[model samples]
Target: MRFPGKVERHAGRARDCGRHFTKTLRRAALAATCASVVALTGCDDKQQVAAAGPPPAVAVTVMTIASHGAAAQIDLSGRVEPIRTAEVRARVDGIVQKLLYTEGTDVNAGAPLFAIDDSDYRAQLEQANAMLQRALAVQTNAQSVVARFRPLVQRQAVSAQEYEAAVSAQGQAQASVADARAAVTLAKLRLERCVVRAPIAGRVGRALVTEGALVSAASATLLAQINQLSPIFATFPKSNTAILDLMDEARQGGLQLSKDIRFPVQITLANGRAYDETGEVDFADLSIDPATGAQSVRARFQNADRVLLPGQFVTGRFRIGERQDAVLVPSRAVALNAGGASVYVVGADDIAHLRQVVLGDQQQGQWEVRSGLATGERVIVDGWQKIAPEQRVRAVEQHGPGPGP
Candidate 1:
């Protein structure tokens, strides 16, 4: 009986312990399940929040298309030159006596340049005059004899052969007088040549031959050089295609070639300063250079200030026409990508898109857009690197108006 009671008590204690272990396990499992469900829900909520947000906005400069007249121009480099240039030389062979004009001075036409030895020339003139007088006296005597012989021949008092000889003598005297007159004329020319004169009104260069230096007419040594400074010439080179285009425009009445082209010419000097005076297109070369395939065009400018010097290199611009209703943007707006030229345009949705454009000539710090952009479209001119294609951006109004006139 005592053993049976002990077994029953042990059985009861084991049953109670088994019930407690089952309850604890159930509670732990319930807590673990609830934690997993909350963690998953938090992750899903975070992902949803991230997807709803947009990409960062790009700060960029924007410009609008404007309606205005802008000129189309071709730029070229050339050299400044005098309108007229002449090398002064000695016309008569003699020792230089005096330099009549100072070096590098402005001289007028017919102004004395240099003086040669006139003493010898004067003596020759005197000799020529003396010879002329003697010839005149001899001619008078021959004429008197001829008159007497004519009458004698008619009256049969003188032989016909003698009368013929008298007539011949008179003819010889007349030939001698003509020869003397030529000699006098030659002497006068030589005297005039003794004083070298400037052929054109211009500025004179340095004197090449000094006083007491013997020079010859055939020698290469020049006395001086004169250059006409006012109304100077500028020679610039342009492509043959450009010339043809200009001609075509003239024929179409789009441009009047005969009118003064000076209004559109702008000159840039070597020092990067703009020339004050305007120039007119004076001449154009008929043929193109085979090597360069370029035609030279010459322009004339009134250089009254004498600022432009000969042989000075200068840049010039010739306005061909005015572009009407053209779209212009700042140079910075055009981006050079691997696919030629492109620009970033902000659409109405404030989203950026890369636009490929055809660019024409540049004018006044802006590029002339030929295609791919229409009026009223906003082009990003600044802050290009920060933006990308399809990226959302806030379009900010850039400072100031569009570039160029």
Candidate 2:
């Protein structure tokens, strides 16, 4: 029921629609092909990345272990003390008449220090002498009577009993004279004590008693103090555990203790200056202190310059022994953790391996390896914290004063 031209137009529109539909299908296929190609390229990139190895070798500084002589040493805080200390005391009861020596001066032994009032002692001595003379006169008279009575008794002019009485009287008179002589000697001794002298040769401190002050002999009143400073003492505390460990090491032939066990000691003053003279260990306490678990060690030093003073504190370095085959590393190379101490050891393959080390003594920024390390092994001195165990590293050899031969 339509015209032939209208039908042809409709047919043409239908043909155009078919062609557009075909073009749309072709564009959709091309888009899919492009998406597949892009996906395949992304997969290949991931595979390439997976084939690559561990990140990169970490850079670290390492030290090589070797046999060398290392000193077994420890540093401790010490207190200065005088070799000998004497407390000057009053020996007699009297008023102090004069102080002979100046305060804070050195005095020789037997030098006069103080003088006390001696009037009473002098009077007592005089009385004793008079008593002795009177007793001597009485004995002479008794002896003459005995001589006269002895002849009379033999001639029957006196009774035997009377002669015996005369002899007894002579004996009593002689005893009195002896007793009086003893009293005189005691009085003289008391008088000598009135003058107080230095009991030792050393430096004396301030006078505790002044002129006119009363001092007592029975109470042993302290007048002053003297301390010998030329040969001084330095006392320091050492840990008992450390002592035992050193002994054990020595016994096992790992350490060579000094002969006679008299270790050498050196001290640094509180002002950070080194002492001129070195000291030797003189005395060590037999027992350890319960509170501190430490042993007291005393060293003697010749302080000719009198630079060291009592009650001053100093730092002491004690060299107890030496290790023949000692292995040492920098203190920075050691890492302390819950399992005690550890370090990073680099192997021949340049791989950093964590090693548990038994530490002995530390000195001059170095630590002595007692166990868990051997010779020719390289230990990481730097960049240890930046690496993990069994990780490859670019080890840089450290030089200058090390455990190397």
Most accurate candidate by lDDT:
2
The C-alpha local distance difference test score for the whole of candidate 2 amounts to: 0.91
Scored by CA lDDT, what does every candidate get? 0.85, 0.91
- C-alpha positional error of residue 145 in candidate 1 after TM-score superposition, expressed in Å: 1.7
Off by over 4 Å in 1: 1-61, 66-69, 242-263, 330-344, 352-359, 381-393, 396-405
lDDT per residue, candidate 1, 174-290, as tens digits? 999999999999999989999999999999999988999998878745888999999899999998987788788667654454345553578999999989887878787888999
TM-score of each model, paired residue for residue: 0.74, 0.69
Q: Model 2, 1-405: lDDT tens per residue?
A: 759998999999999999999999999999999999999999998888888856889999987888889997888998999999999998889999999999888899999999999999999999999999999999999999999999899999999999999999999999999999999999999999899999898889999999999999999999999998889999999999988887898999988988765788989999999898999998989999999999999999989988898899999998987888998888888998888999999999998889999998777778888899998899888899998899999999986435422
Ten contiguous residues with the weakest lDDT in model 2: 396-405
Candidate 2: give the clashing pairs. none
TM-score, cand. 2: 0.69
